[model samples]
Target chain A: MSTTTPPRPRRSRAERYRSALWLLTKRDLRVRYSTSALGYFWSILDPLVMSGIYWFVFVVVLDKGGDIGEKPYIVFLIAALLPWMWFTGTISDSTRAFLREAKLVRSTSIPRTIWVARLVLSKGLEFLASIPVLIIFAVIFGAQANWNLVWTYPLAIILQAILVLGLGLIVAPLVVFFRDLERAVKLILRFLFYASPIVYSTLDIPAAIQPWAALNPLTGIFALYRSGLYPEQLMVFPIVMSAVISVLVLGIGLLVFRRYERAVLKEI
Target chain B: MTEPIISVTDLGIHFRRNKARRRSFKDLFAGSARRSRPGEFWAFRNLSFDVAPGEAIGVVGRNGQGKSTLLKLVAGVILPDEGRVRVNAGVAPLIEITGGFVSDLSVRDNVYLTAGLHGMTKAEVAARFDEIIAFAEIEDFVDTPYKHLSSGMKVRIAFSVIAQLDEPVILVDEVLAVGDKAFREKCYGRIDELLSAGRTLFFVSHNERDLRRFCSRGIYLDKGKLVLDGPIADVLDRYNADYNNPTP
Candidate 1:
């Protein structure tokens, strides 16, 4: 019953999906960096400049030297901002995941989730590359580091990746349906920047509002990053809340994506 | 005698009058966004057809009659709103503007990325890399970004990649209609080789000589309905008569 077909080995669906995902992630990174000779340096420039501005405003100008962070406040500021940039960048790009790539989105046979997941991976890599900036800052500022960093840093990365991937899957498809939601997401990110514990530690939040603040998943992620240098910033309650919320967001994201995928395809 | 490799049953897709406009939040509250019934009409409804394995089918139609939409449905890119398009084999769609590449990627990366997107392994793409590049006649621009390429060059790359695909069902939607005369001839020759090897083709084009060269069976479409389906010469005759005798 068989006609003579090509003898090439048929790869499993998962294998093909994985390879396609990696190939696309590589493309994103190359496109963002390959054209610029100082890609890595320029990529980290935004967070570095932001840290400096905050340091100048709070530490130098206001003379609140001890209030901002531990000695060499720049390390503390850079630690939280790097991951924040990763979070916001992925979510922002997610708005256009289907719209910007409509042609390929409608053409390729690859699983659609790869489109969202690739953004998380590429942005995560950029965040990872900027970690050395924190390290060199730590050495220069002499920020205290505990042996617990070995586990906490990587744990935070895994959590952030899951969180962003879930949010992206949810955002990318929904924006295809509601184009205005793209601008809505931008507004939310702006609020989230001040709302998240990037400029200040979670410990600094008023005791009355701390419980409500724990609802923000990032309160815990930032704690994990900061806990590497300042042990007091790590709180078990918010960290546990973040873990639960990250997993929950991912579950909801998958459902939202599956429900609206067809409509998204049509809309795009 | 064999089962049809592709089956379309009561297939329909709809378009809204204001499909270009996203529903406002007020529409969401008013519940108008939830209903799929209003301000919409089927582009093609209750359509049924099938293609047998290794069958080379020509789909001839005037502009905007749903030919390209049919190929999109078969390729599983656009979901059918009513019935379904069932194909037993993998579909390799030779479409434009979707070489399955990020526009910023280099030609070399795009070649690998696109082929991989369709399930071609790295080793397989590696083996055909030089062949694809040489066929496209763009060895000099291997490292250049895809967005910088001329439209003709884009078509060349798309064809080169799709031609290397092992997928049994190939959808060619006027892909050969573009590019210069010499390159188009080269593309036609490649298609001829593939057809001789028994690949299933769904070729759509307005060019009669080109259609006749590739297809033994033709289906003529007008007003989003199948007007005639028969031997190539007969279908071509009906198409011409309809063209000459326009509706008032």
Candidate 2:
């Protein structure tokens, strides 16, 4: 309505991206902790509690394997669960990211990309918060401390983030058009838990189907995680592949997301 | 003299509704025939307006009118279907008072977050933090989660944060109707301050009193087309006359 020129030029992509990421991360942290009495403890406790349940199932009930060469089953599960939690959390949260913030999407003129980026970054922070818990579990179990573990651990985290963000961008917008996609994603994630190498190793799959297992992005990510938590094992190629696939999925997902972004806001 | 800060020419928006019979799964494989519904519906057609720096204009109409749609287009929240909006100045839209605030966040944190989205640096917000809180009159609840606050509290906090921004042009929707009378008066006072400082304001409201008090000029939009644009008193009189006497 007012015709005065805005003081500055259009914001650059880097500026918008950084601002969006910061605002989203701040909102996530503030909102998550604001109402709760326990606050920051929830971040560490969620993964720890989930790991305990899995420990009871895989280590106690099944007793399939223990401490792959010195790493306790609890340590192994915690390590893998940390990244898995991040992946699943990001997928679920980012799926509803745009829809849940429809008011912001409809009211303010901030770029829509911020919605997806914020959701991903906030989940990434939660994943980072769980790292200390993973390290503590490793220390208690006397897992080996190798330089390879340090380097590979960060690589796996980055890959998991990309894969989740990419998948979120692709699926979240589709959710606006097909309401059933939300339910389908939940069902698929449940199916993928067992399909993924979360509870067991890719080796458990018959050798004839091992190639198909490699196609699951989580398979490569978990394999890399196991290798880092226990450097004695070999998971180099799987980690590399996971990183590559994550980048590709993210790139393609962003393209699709941007293409449909205008409609997504309208439909929602 | 400076160029007009806001330029909109031949702006139009249409929403299309699809009424084709959905194909069943079996019919999909069998290539069953389908019939299409009516074509697109025009929400607004061939609308044009311009605003100069430091001008205060009011947009008024009844519900189901295209006032909100035009505001959305101006704010860039939604794109215009057929035409373009060229905004030369920064925009601060108060379309939904608490649009940016996450109710789960504390008032203080929401202020920082909202300011950050407006491209304000953390340090700048920090400098204005106290002033914003004081203006909103929620000093005691600044640290509390916003979700726990009453609707009035939320609006107050949101308005306070918005008032601190240094944008050249501000777009205000009818959300000011939510706050208490005293608070609403304060909001108008703030707008008066902005106008006195030579900032342009585009306000949309159903209240004639607000339009008369805050705006120097008025634009009447009926079904997305501008019907009248001129001095506030004359435009409002014409709008009232047109409303009182409808064309058959």
Candidate 3:
């Protein structure tokens, strides 16, 4: 039942997971970039193209562009849209995190949570890399930097990271057990694209609907992001709501992940 | 008589068929009742064993007889259905030849990454990097992407990385099949070196001669049951007789 010999000191669970998380994250980043010729350029290109299309269609073609505010509609759209791309991209990819590396999951004894964490970390790195693009747009649009911008950016980044971790933790294991969750997750994210305030500001919604819309954690997150670009439109309600909801989702996601972690290997 | 470095009590593992999974869109939308339940079957059942330090164990069985399952249970990759497996020492599992290799990463990168996953620190992997590459004899291709390597080169790289891992127990499942004759000889030499250094080994091989070469004791499993367990010669004799003269 026990060893009389002096065993090598075992690393704590947190330490082991931390190391594995780092290595896997590195591997994911290297593999992703090495496959394509353009490499990291592809990360910025996705949001740039997407924002350009939305800007042209909404501002040039549709009448909604004039209502966005003093800043160019492109600037406003990039501020909100870049973070949305990161949040949605991380969540969707993480749904297949475990399933993608079925052999690695079955072969290694590293904590299974590292798979989902790798996806989050790698995508987060991409999101961070894309921030310079956002800053360039803001400078061109003549948006003035303020003291509030410094804290708000990190705050939004940390909150969105936490929210993605929690959701990914839940989705990664759940999709392994229920394969259809992979498809269902994509569908839900597509619907959520319109549901969140990605294109237009949340203020444009009716006052009756604004409170209901604020219930979405992303509404608060996007509000935080948008507030950085257009401080005049900043609302504290969504930021506070996002903070509360992120913690709740993190707690629930951890519970779901732990419950299903052991069962996942057998199912896969 | 000594305490086992690895012990299994009432160990069992069962797998459910894919039919039991809610894989269809209709199944998710319509709920659980519409999906057919997958039948469950045990891979191994009611098995118990204890492996002493420095013992080399040969796990022999026919295909689909849970030979690999037992190794997986010991390595802690899969959970046992009803019972426990307690490993009191570090384990290195060679279940897949390219288990953790990223195709786009260079061989040098994979060596560090794979070694780190097995609990080696960055400094440790760096110290042994040259030794692993030399042992694998692919130092020329160390900077090449893993996908670019031929299948044989990949195996050599993977085996070299794992061979340098300093674990108390090593679980090998038929990785010898991948290597060339020269590499297999190197692997045999490595096994001899490991045994001499007092490492515990559990080798699962279908080749009887390969098992006899490395193992002093043999465990024969038949249809998830412990058919025989004893000295290598006796267990092999019984196994060979059973196979040569089948019961109707």
Best by TM-score: 1
True contacts kept of 2: 0.49
| lDDT scores of the candidates, listed in order | 0.84, 0.77, 0.82
- Candidate 3: pairs in clash: B20-B38
Which residue runs does candidate 2 get wrong by more than 4 Å? A1-13, A66-71, A231-237, B16-40, B139-141, B144-150, B227-242, B245-248
Write candidate 3's Cα lDDT for B1-248 as tens digits: 88999998998777665546454535434543312345667777888888999999999777888999899888888877678999988888888858788887889998999989988889878878898998988889989988999999888988877777868898999988877898999888887877777889999997888788889889888877888889987887888787774323
Considering only N, C-alpha and C atoms within 3 Å, which residue pairs clash in candidate 2?
A3-B5, A3-B6, A5-B88, A5-B89, A6-B88, A6-B89, A6-B90, A67-A71
In the range B38-112, model 2's lDDT, one tens digit per residue, is 455667778887899989999877776788878878888887766689988778788776888887676777888
Instruction: Supply candidate 2's per-residue lDDT for B246.
Output: 36
Index of the highest-DockQ prediction: 1
Prediction 2 TM-score vs. true:
0.85
* DockQ for each model: 0.42, 0.35, 0.37
TM-score of each: 0.90, 0.85, 0.89
lDDT of 3 at A87: 88
Model 1 over residues A62-84: C-alpha lDDT tens digits?
A: 98768755556788899999999
Question: Fraction of true contacts kept, per model?
Answer: 0.53, 0.49, 0.53
Interface RMSD of 3: 5.7
Model 3: TM-score for chain B: 0.90
